[model samples]
Target chain A: MLEVLAERFNYAVIIVLMMVGLYAVIATGNLVKRLVGLSIFQTSVFLLYISVSKVFGGAPPIFDYKDLAYDKLDPNAIYSNPLPHVLILTAIVVGVATLSVGLALVVRIREAYGSIEDDTLAEADYSLELEKGV
Target chain B: MSASDITQYFDYIFMAMLLCIGIAVIRLRNLFAVVMLTGAYSLISAAWFVSLDAVDVGFTEAAVGAGISTVLLLGAMLLTSREADKTSLGRHAAAAVVTIAAGAGLFYALGDMPVYGDAASPANTGVGMEYVDLTAEQIVIPNVVTAVLASYRGFDTMGEVFVVFAAGLGVALLIGLGGSKREED
Candidate 1:
């Protein structure tokens, strides 16, 4: 039981973090808070990917050539998987791009409605529906 | 203990910090403080990534997550209100239920996963190793991640670039490109 716990503890923590983000996204009425929650959620997923790629005794994926001159390369040198690193690097940038776009939308919504709360926006829509008789 | 043992402890500490920050962000009503906390969370995450042997990813996370994202959120906050409106307990409870359900489902699935840091696991044994091995001969770049990103999976990156470009265009269209022009008009 202890062994399993030790092995899976990181995943457990990540799940808790993810749930917190989800709660914020769903429960918060503020648009900026929702985006912050979304970012937390995204970062947790990145942690998960980076965690999966880890090798117990691995070095960073950068190749070291210092050993090449002294002797033949050590055949057993371990490296953490580079593929996920590459993917997540791109993802982090893309996450920011999407975040900026979301914030821009929030700014525009505030300009149009004069409030950034989802409930306020919903109330406005509800009154509009009453006026439209729909 | 050993260096790896110390790193493991660091991993636990950073993860604990991340959880605390997540809770703090949810609990804080002041958006400015919350945004700053999120940036701190990202910075800690980057440090954790370094311990996990993902230096390149850590560098990008520090730059994009901690730096650019925080700046963007603060700029957005300037145009919106500072304090978040209070949410009803009923909505909080409903959200908690949904979050707990999702978390429990993932927890159940977690049992089937390979142990953390098992090099022989499917993920570590596959083409990830192939890229690490082939980068020297095929691309001659010391950094395997860069080689695979720029050469092996160039198309995927091209798509990501397009997505980023589209997002920038959307932001500019929604809010004017020049900040001064918006204020002037």
Candidate 2:
């Protein structure tokens, strides 16, 4: 157990960050702050993937074509795993786009309700519903 | 301690900074400062990613996470309240419970994960190496990550581009361009 803890301590720390993000998303009434929490959570996952790709004494995934011929590729050459990097590239773009749209929606919500706090927005919504009922 | 040991300590320092920043983001009531701290947090994360030899991922994180996202958050902050309301103590207690429980559960699950940076770890030994090995012959790109993203995962990348486009459209529809003649009229 001690050995496992020592080896994977990084992951435990990252998971703690993930939880902090999760808490912010759920607990914060400010919509933009919630999005910040969402960003933190997404980033923690990205770090986990990057951590998984690390290779001891490995160079970056970029190949230096000037140094070595493609045909005579060195079998023993070490490079950090590139697959996770590729996967996360697309994800990062999507994250930014999603955040932009979320912000725009927050702008619209503020325009509608005169407040961006989730609780205040919900109160406005419930009052609208009550007015219709009465 | 050797150079590698020193680097490991740097990692520890970065991780500690990340933890402190995360707590600060949650505890602070000032929305603008929280957004700025989030940007700083992501920049540190990019530094960590670069240290892990994920230069491409780090680059993307710096551009998207710290750059574009911060600008968007700031623009939104311009339209929203600057400070968040304080929640009840009961809500704080509930949030703390939920966060600690989730963290403990994930920590327990970490015991089964492959040790960090092990060359033979499943993530490295699987299709990961095949991409590295074949990128030279098949794609001829200096960056294997770029080759795989453009050639091997063309469909997924295209979908992501379309998603970005759609998101832009959605934002434009929701919040019209302020300087546009259509909005001015």
Candidate 3:
């Protein structure tokens, strides 16, 4: 048990962060707070991907351009795998876009219904439905 | 202490800080403080990413997570109340149950993942190694991440860029430049 825990401590931490974010998204009533939760949750997954891409003794995945040698592997270098980083770069941008849209929606929601709380918003909509007999 | 041990210690410290801040965000009713803490959480996690040999991802995380999202969230908050509506105990309980179950499921499955930072891990061995080894030879770029994102996966990046553009257009259509005109009249 101890060995398993030690080997994957980072995973455990990531999982805890994920759960916190999930709880925030699920439990929070405020729209903005829920979005914050969603951001936290998205970044946790980002960290998880970064963690997977790490190389134990790896350097950052950039070359020192001054040394303009040609073909062979540099014995001193252990570059971190760049695939996950590439995927995450795209993901980070998309996450920002998603947050922007979500916040815009929240702004419009506040304008449309005087309140951003889910329960209050639902109540207002429900009362509107009742009044309309639909 | 050895260098790796020290690095691991820092990792643990940052993870602990993240965990604490996450709890604080959940516990606090003031939405403003929670928003700020969320940014701090992003900043710290970005640092963690740097330590994991993912400097490129770390840079993007710092930029997107800490900077842009914080500013946007704060902008949105200006249009809403600062205090959050507290959730009922039963609702929170249900959320906790779901979160725990999800956490436990991930935890159990984690052992199957390649150990952290093993270069010989499955992800690093086949196509990934091919990309790394061939990227410089064929592309002549100093940064493998840039080459892969811009050249190899150019289509995906283009799609993402368009997604961002579309999202901006959507936000503009939803809120307008001056924000719903306030309608004070």
Candidate 4:
């Protein structure tokens, strides 16, 4: 049981981080806080992919040409999976792009509604609806 | 102890730090502190990435996560309020319930996962190995990650660039490029 726990502990940490992010997104009323939660969530997923790509006794995915000549390359030379790293490189860029857009929307919300809190904005909308009905 | 043992200990330390940061981000009411903690969280995660043999990913994470994201969040903070309003108990309870349920489900699935750093795991074999083996002959690049990212997956990278462009366009269209220029006009 202890060995299993040790082996799978990375996933366990990731899941906890993910849960914290999700809770923040759901529970926080502040728009900026929600975006922070979203970022935390996105980052946890990044960690997960990188963690999955790790190989024991492996080097980083950079080839040492002197030690690993093209003609006499060792097939047993271990490297962490580069495919996931490639995927995550794009993901980190996309994550930032998404974050910038989200922040822009939050700024726009504050400007238009005069409040960034979800509850305050909802209450204002409700009052506006009541005024229109009367 | 062996090197792997030390690496494992480092992983544990990083994970514990991340957990503490995550909880702090959640419990803190001050937005400035939260933003700073988020950047620290990213930097620590980047360090963890390096230990995991993902140098390129770590480099990118440090630049984008800790640097750009923190700046962007600070800019947004300037436009918005600093303190988050108190959330009600009921809402907190509901979110906790949902998060716990989701976490339990994922935890149950974790049993079937390959042990950490098992080289023969499915993710490390097959196509990943193929890229590692082929890069020397095909791309002649020292960095297998660079070779695969720029060559084998060039189209994907192009698509990602387009996505980033679209996001920038969206932000500009929504709020303009910076300063009071858009507001003044």
Task: Look at candidate 4 and tell me the lDDT of residue A133.
Answer: 100
Tell me the TM-score that candidate 3 gets on chain A alone.
0.93
- Model 2 stretches with alpha carbons more than 4 Å out: A69-72, B1-6, B179-185
Root-mean-square deviation of every model:
2.2, 2.2, 2.6, 2.1
The best candidate by lDDT is: 4
Residue runs of model 4 more than 4 Å from their true location after superposition: A1-3, A67-72, B1-5, B179-185
lDDT of 2 by residue, B37-151 (tens): 9999999999998888888888888988899899889889988889998977887788889888888888878878988767888878999889998888788778899888989
Worst 10 residues of 1 chain B by lDDT: B1-10
Chain A TM-score, cand. 2: 0.93
Cα DockQ of the candidate 2 complex: 0.72
- Which stretch of 10 consecutive residues in model 3 chain B shows the poorest summed lDDT? B1-10
Model 3 C-alpha lDDT per residue in residues B1-185, reported as the tens digit of each score:
11133356678889999999999998999988998998999899989988887888888889988999999999889888899987999999999899999989998898887776677889777676678777768887788889898998899999999999998898888887665588754
lDDT of 2 at A90: 86
User: Could you tell me which residue pairs clash in candidate 1?
Assistant: none
10 residues in a row with least lDDT, candidate 4 chain A: A66-75
| Cα error of candidate 4 at position B149, Å | 0.9
The CAPRI-style docking tier of model 3 reads medium
Each model's C-alpha lDDT? 0.89, 0.86, 0.86, 0.90
Q: What lDDT does model 2 reach?
A: 0.86
Interface RMSD for candidates 1 onward, in order:
2.0, 2.0, 2.0, 1.8
Candidate 2 local lDDT, A1-134, one digit each (tens): 87787777778788988998999887888899999999999999988888888877788988777644536567788998999999887898898999999999999998988998888888888999999996
